[model samples]
Target: MAEKPRLYYFNGRGRMESIRWLLAAAGVEFEEVFLETREQYLKLLEDGFLLFEQVPLVEIDGMKLTQTRAILSYLAAKYKLYGKDLKETALIDMYTDGTMDLIFLIAMLYFKPPEQREKETELVVEKAKSRYFSVFEKILKNHGQDFLVGNKFSWADIQLLEVILMVEELSATALSKFPLLQAFKARISNIPTIKKFLQPGSQRKPQPDDHYVATVKKVLLM
Candidate 1:
């Protein structure tokens, strides 16, 4: 007998968006469970086989998988969307890790208090985005129209989209400075698979839970 399919989820957190994109890209069947509050999230951990730990987890036939990038790799390879060879796989893994760096910065911006935000942001903007995005430019130039390794769809390309959307949310001008990056984002936005998933009403259950939206609004208002 065939085993039952597993449940995929994000804890109302943006960290899982890229993994969702990967699953959607490969036309996989999965459920996106978004928990609204910390209480709800914690409750989820205790209510089922899900242990108290983190969000953005996947439960397969009762097996729990954690860590965003690991989940992405599992889905990508399991679905044959990873890449053609080990070299290509290496590239996919490289950018997937890089995308996490981008995400960690965004996550920091969320809980960072206003008093020290200036100093904290300066470190991220100057040290992180400023540093890596330049390398991103050269890679796109050298690699081709595709963002990471070559001119084909890969996990790396999808990995960049949510990060782009996140950065675009934070500062459009800063995001716009990398014209190619913006253009690349737009191109990926129009990918047939993604376009289908992004359809207005087709998004079921809950929308991408922005962990930072309300927090940022508070910071700006104060």
Candidate 2:
């Protein structure tokens, strides 16, 4: 049997959380090595595991892979979640890219100064609703399908679901205006694998708190 993929990152969700979600959605079991100390991170560099001195790395298929996008694309294709053809693959990529943009904006909120955090949270929620979520709502309404791209469960759908939940964490009513998205979220979250991941005691990480923020700052020397 092939070994499970080993993930290298901090305990909290940064870029690695999406990778974790994708793997779980694919029903693949993997192990995680948390970087709790700067020494551990430096050790990875010394061992030449971090090619660019960065993580969200995966050791899989007898190869050590870095770069989050590259890792996600490889996994999506390997698990047949990418698409059936070039056109479908293109659409999946487009949708996934847009979700990443929104995810980045939400993640940055964790690093904001306390005084500015509330203001930034409101801005992030507004941008998510106006700029990103609205685009997905339109896509779902026009596609009128169970899943995005070829009406099949693909990486695009997974990415959209992940971002939808993230936005909701910031503002519970974030999806109130988008009926299609609300339905889409309900449907996708009910998938057997996804449902399991959403339950307690799963690999899924909770929203970042003060401890997570501090660990990240310490490990990265920020």
Candidate 3:
């Protein structure tokens, strides 16, 4: 028997979601350690459990990994969710990086002060939807395939779906114009394991304004 991999993040999905979806999709059983409080996260930070003082940490194969993309890529390769060849892998990386960039912008909106959030939200949404979302739509159109790379489901598509959901959460109108991207979301969500994960009462939680993000902001103020 193999050791069950352990994932450390806040109780909410956040950056760890792509990993969670990949783990579920790959049928890999893993342990989730939720840091529900600032004290818990600070303790881990003091104890040197986090490499970059961030969450979404993973312990697998006796290695402690940080960074969302790095963790997702490692799991994808380990569980055969990665591309079939070097070229495909490179394209996957490109798409994954693009998703991460969008994720970062959304995170900025979430962390922005309430007073500035309205204006920030408008600017971020306009820029992101036009630039990032349009680029993604073009990619899907160009590939003319169900998946981002090699016409097969890969970590890239999974991450892309996650980002698309994030955009929708932030703006609430992201998918209205991007029919292909909307279809992509449906395709990924229909995967058996992912569908199971999406069921009501599943471990996944709703996005933004969650307790975890609130606690972190309060702690930062203290």
Best TM-score goes to which candidate?
2
Give a tens-digit lDDT track for model 1, residues 1-222.
434335444343456666667777776656665554456555666766454465566775456777766777788888777778988888878877887887777666655667786677666665545776776767887766764765787778776776666665555666656777867877888988877777775432233334445532332342
lDDT of 2 by residue, 83-201 (tens): 88899999999999989988998898999898999999999999999998888888888969989889999999898999999989989999999999999999999999999999999
Alpha carbon deviation, residue 214, candidate 3 (Å): 3.0
lDDT winner, 2 or 3: 2
Task: Report the poorest 10 consecutive residues by lDDT, candidate 2.
Answer: 134-143
TM-score of every prediction relative to native = 0.75, 0.98, 0.88
Error of 1 at 70 (Å): 2.0
Compared to the true structure, candidate 1 yields what TM-score? Answer: 0.75
Q: How many residue pairs clash in each candidate at the backbone level?
A: 0, 0, 0
**Candidate 2: misplaced stretches above 4 Å?**
none
- Which lDDT tens digits does candidate 3 get at residues 114-139? 88988987887887779878888898
lDDT of 2: 0.93
Which residue pairs clash in candidate 3? none
